[model samples]
Target: MIKLTKLAVLCSLIALPTQALARDVNDLGVDVQAATSAYIVKNTNPRYPGSYNGSRLEGWALMSYVVDTQGKAKDIEVIMASDTRGSEENAEKYLTNLEFAPATKEGKTVEGGYLFSFEVGKYFNGYSNDKASRGFINEYDEINKLLQAKEFKKAELALAELYKDHTKNTSEQALFAWLKSQYYYHQQQWFGFDEQLSVAYLLRAKLPTDIQYLVAKSALQWYSFKGDFNLAYNAIYALDNIEGKEFSEENKLATIKQIDDLLARTPQINSQINVSKDKLSYLSLSRGSIKIEGASDVSKLQIRCADQVVDLEASELVNYVIDEQSRRCGLLVKSANPAEIKVKQTGYAIVNSKFDAS
Candidate 1:
């Protein structure tokens, strides 16, 4: 598979209108806020998830329209669009003769220019690639609309369908991977660790060198999230080897700093797979004291402390310790939300609290 470099990520995400339609921001006669509802409709089908050359190619287009007092579209413009000049000219021709119900402001008909951004794309909905020529952006919008209308299952079904089918085109595929990874990560799907790693590794392979840093960064993110310091460190070092030759010293240092931060918090992380953990949980002034409970049978527990809920995590347990020089320490223990404590065979008791008591 061709490694789709991240450099073209933005391009891949957006469908280029056949022609460029951006204008000087000053030429937008009205403030963006005022033209909220105004839009110029087009006759062409917005490409979304569907068979183009007999294979699904996911895409979408966005355009803005200036409306007149007569409820007529005075101008049709593509915003942040990519396409040929001929397509743009055709879009303009379609807009010039377009009709719209005039708008009213302060009880009077007023020439109002509004920007309308319309999109259509594929969704996870059971709609197959053969059914819709678009992908995620369109599907996402429709699902959102349904959700906004309070149709949750319908929206979910759309997503389910998209996931089942077009889970390959970089866009559609990425969405599925993201949702699955998040689900497994949150559930601490330790069994799926290698699969998750494979996806991150694959993404790293696909992204271009210019944006390979992002891939490496993502890998580090998974490593840290999984509390696998060793793996995270290895990934960081590997990235350093690959990127060191090309990136400036300052850039490399910045990346290293991020990795260092991740490493600094390793000790507080639970080594056992069955434990539910909170490195930092929030509290309010209305409550004092926290209770800690075990997520499962464990012999150790830990929590990082802070002056406030500013920075809390299971790892870096010492951070919760009150500084001797400080007169008052923020409260760490709470009543209803006591940090449920737990421990593994290591016999660690970790809990973090911030206090500022005089």
Candidate 2:
């Protein structure tokens, strides 16, 4: 695997916001979603390696990056790829020479991020489309129109309804995630935007490439900020046994290093969740374990992942350690009295980090 000597993701965005930031879009009274988006000004694909000039082996690489005010690409992530031999390295090298037309907001150049996907000798045009149901499509169109009309309240109601019923298929879920994320973005509600964006990220393979880009770009910020290295990487590696799924992380070296850096810079989480009989408390972890500070005060604890849940009896003290398998997982603390729960990163996350770039 080829490695960058040093990498700082998304320019200076590594220190992710905990949703209480002042530098977010809300500081500027402008509609970010309606603002002009960035575009490539100079995109020259890297030359095929001479060693594989006539070889049958080929691959593709997809990167997620931001265009700074000066139109320079920074904080790049090798978000997806195919078996593209050494094409992943070439894609990283291409960043030095690539440029973009900076996006404009409120008549001034502003920073925005996007995707760049390329393929080599082997073109997998069979990359299939994962479509939503007709009912979902119609409702999606209506919700989009409402958002465009700036009917925020109606759009929120529609999104709530859609969320309740979008579970019929992965594609429908992805579409709903993308739409709701855009809704929060327009209002500069960063907290809601990234939280819902993380949903689209989990079902990334079901989303179109463009939607994947938007989801990934925002994910780099939200997940990294929360110190959820395991969950963040797991979301990007969400490809299942689905046939015709084009994106593969066979070349995870680049993205792994990027996430490592983001996670390293994100402040460690040593927080508490107080639970009561009347309400259940939820705690999201980036990488760490959970312990009940006063187990005697708790009645039940639900250790939750994206798809599974493990219930623990809280009659005694409880300590649950998190590892690579604990992905996109959270904890639901239940207590008859007010119980103090502590969550912190015990060690860095490592599941399949030993990837071969060759």
Clashing residue pairs in candidate 2 (N, C-alpha, C atoms within 3 angstroms): 9-75, 10-75, 59-84, 227-286, 228-286
Please write out the lDDT profile of model 2 over residues 195-305, one tens digit for every residue: 456546544555776667556656655655555554455444432222454555554446667776776665456655555454445555555455655555665565543
Residue 1, model 1: Cα distance from true site in angstroms: 21
Q: Give the top-scoring candidate (TM-score).
A: 2
Scored by Cα lDDT, where does model 1 land?
A: 0.36
Clash numbers, per candidate:
66, 5
Worst ten in a row by lDDT for model 1: 4-13
In terms of lDDT, the poorest run of 10 residues in model 2 is 6-15
TM-score of every prediction relative to native: 0.29, 0.44
Give all candidates' CA lDDT scores: 0.36, 0.51
Candidate 1 lDDT tens digits, 144-260? 566557565575577677665545443344344444443444446644433433343433323335435554566667655754433344455446645433545576566556656
